[model samples]
Target: MDDSKEAESQLNEKLYETRMKFANLWESCNPVRFKQKYGESLKITRDRCIEIYEEEKQMCDKVEITKKNIAEQNALIKKMQEDLQIANQKFESNNKQKQEMLKKIKQLKEELAKKQELISTQKQENKAKLKELNTSAEMFKKRMGLEIRRVHGEQLQFIFKCINSKNPEQLFTFLLRFNEEGNYEVMSCDPPLECMPLLQEKLKETNNLSAFLANVRKAFAALV
Candidate 1:
């Protein structure tokens, strides 16, 4: 606007100068004075026009440079905006992933707790079943009536070393039945009976007579 105003003012000034020269020429019939005065006026107006032209040219150059700078800045701003949008999208995606992972962790924790509860319930059920199994085993053994017999006298004087077995269900049913018939001494292997439970537990670890008898002997030695 300023450049346009300046150009307009220069053009108006030129038009005014031309009108004044024509008026002066019309008033003065003397061509000599007209030439001299008009020549100076023309020089001054030409110099003014040249000055205005230079100013206008400089302003045009400034406007072009400013336009170019504004264009570059706008392009840079657009690129920055695009980058920011992309970054925001990435951040949102990552945040969503983190939330999903947390949800998964929560689900896993709940499942683990449920599994632990199930295991505890199963253990309780197993205990009850084991108790029933033991009771049934005792009843079965009584019905079967398997008893140890015939194999010991002066020919095999044995010193029985065994756990201070109290569970009638757990006791060697064969030995008990024969003890009644044979009248064998049934003493606890231990002197204080402190290690008898451990002895029984050890014996229960195995199935064979060799291992069972070996643990009994170890209990006897421990008592001594």
Candidate 2:
């Protein structure tokens, strides 16, 4: 391709040189004066005139051909330049669009990262709250059990005091009523106790409340 361009340049230079030579030949020729001086020798002058005319005509034809070629080449060069300019503009536009897309993608990734961090933080907070609630519930259960045991101890002391008192039968009757109140009904203790069973037999046989009370106290001691 470089060789072809070099050849074309050399051809253009030669054509220009030839055209300039023809122009100089026309400028130096004094046609009217030559005719006036050579009219007496008309035959010689007429032949010379015809030869010069043919030369001028051939030069003009060559110049016209060169001009036509130059015009066509100029038109082609203008079109090529325009095409190159359009291509460059398109390339710049595509590059600008690519840069914008990259920026948007980077922004989206940053937002996603922030959202993921927030979700992880929320999960950790929820776990901590659940642990705290479980700890509080355990403490409440222990406190409730302790309170029930303490109240049961007080009731047991009172029953022990009335175990062999005067009018023991009347005391037993009162104790039976007290047991029915359900205050000492501790289902979660190490061992369970019920006062109603102890008095049931005695009350049926001889209405002997003292014996029932004594028997219940003994059973109570063994259970504890």
Candidate 3:
């Protein structure tokens, strides 16, 4: 009976020691659950980082669109400036041409006025020359009438030359006449032989001897 009691006591003591070792192992393994929870938190942080990156990409695309619009507006403004410069040059050239045409017209008008003035001066000079010619013809006619009677005989031949050179109107109006025994006479006292040719010329030109002789004695009667 004592041997049987001793064996049961040893078995109970071994069971107590095994139970203590199992409790120590369970205590050390409990911290492994906390490490697993930290891993799940890291996965959530990675998801938030991806969301921020997508928002930044959208902002960059909007800036590129605004820059393209500005470039198009600048090209249109440059073309308009070039067109304005060309138009101004054309207008200046046209104005210069108009001024030259007006200057030429004024010069032509001045030349025409000078020519008209010269013509008027020449016409006045011609009128004075014609008036002097008429006065000289009258003086010559009076001289021819006096000399024929003063120089008698053959000297009367010189008076014939004066009558031929004188105007036709002078010779017909200034000849002398006389009356002898109530009969009309002409060129007798002046040695009338030299006067025959001059008198014959007058009759040949007129074709009216009686009428021409009458016109000479009508104005004056001189003894010759």
Candidate 4:
């Protein structure tokens, strides 16, 4: 009976030691204790996740703003391009009008030059004709023994005296005038001779002053 009691006591001690080791290990690995120890680390991890999410959200907002700004800029660029096109069209139209005006001015200058040239030629021709008329008048005065006097602005008087002839006492006087059409006509004769009508008719037909004077001399001699 004594030996069995001692053995039982030894067994109790061993079992107590085993139970103590198990309790110590359980305390070290307890779920509650583990959570308490790592609680601060878990909170730090969660805060980092939140910060990353906020940063991502801010990035998304910035991207949206940037996209909106790009769209507005594109619209402005398109408007500016359209305005430039309209300006170019107006410039081209104005340039065309300017060119046409220049062409018309050149044409007017050419026409004016031609008219000036024609006027100069006509003036020279008129001067030549006036000189010829003066020469003819000088020859007629010397050859026909004719004396002329200005009757009015448009009329002349001519007197012819018969000399070295059978009718030396005879005198021929006539008035010459220009008609409205610038033609010469005999207006009146001093003698009122019967041949005056025939002389006037011939003068109207021929317009020859030399022939008229010769015929007048013959008529005067025949009368003598």
lDDT of all the models against the reference?
Answer: 0.57, 0.54, 0.48, 0.74
**How far off is residue 100 in model 3, in Å?**
3.0
| Predicted structure with the largest lDDT when compared to the true one | 4
- Residue lDDT tens for model 3, 1-224: 89988999988888878877776666546577546656677777777777777777777777777777777777777777777777777777777777877777777777777666655554454334223323433443364342223234211211222333334233332233322221122344233344545554574566443443433333223322
How do the residues 1-224 of candidate 2 rate in per-residue lDDT, one tens digit apiece? 99999999999999999999987777557687566656758977788999999999999999999999999999999999999999999999999999999999999999999878876675565445334334533443343211111234323222232234443332221222223221122222222346544445454455443444345555545543
Error of 4 at 187 (Å): 22
| Candidate ranking (TM-score, best to worst) | 4, 1, 2, 3
TM-score of each: 0.44, 0.37, 0.29, 0.45
Over 6-94, each residue of candidate 4 has an lDDT whose tens digit, in order, gives 99999999999999999988876899877876897799989999999999999999999999999999999999999999999999999
Total colliding residue pairs, candidate 4 = 0
User: Which runs in model 1 stand beyond 4 Å of their true positions?
Assistant: 1-27, 125-224
Task: Pick the winner on TM-score between candidates 1 and 4.
Answer: 4
The candidate that achieves the highest TM-score relative to the unseen native structure: 4
- Candidate 3 global lDDT: 0.48
Q: Which pairs clash (backbone N, Cα, C closer than 3 Å) in model 1?
A: none
Q: Which model, 1 or 4, shows the larger lDDT? A: 4
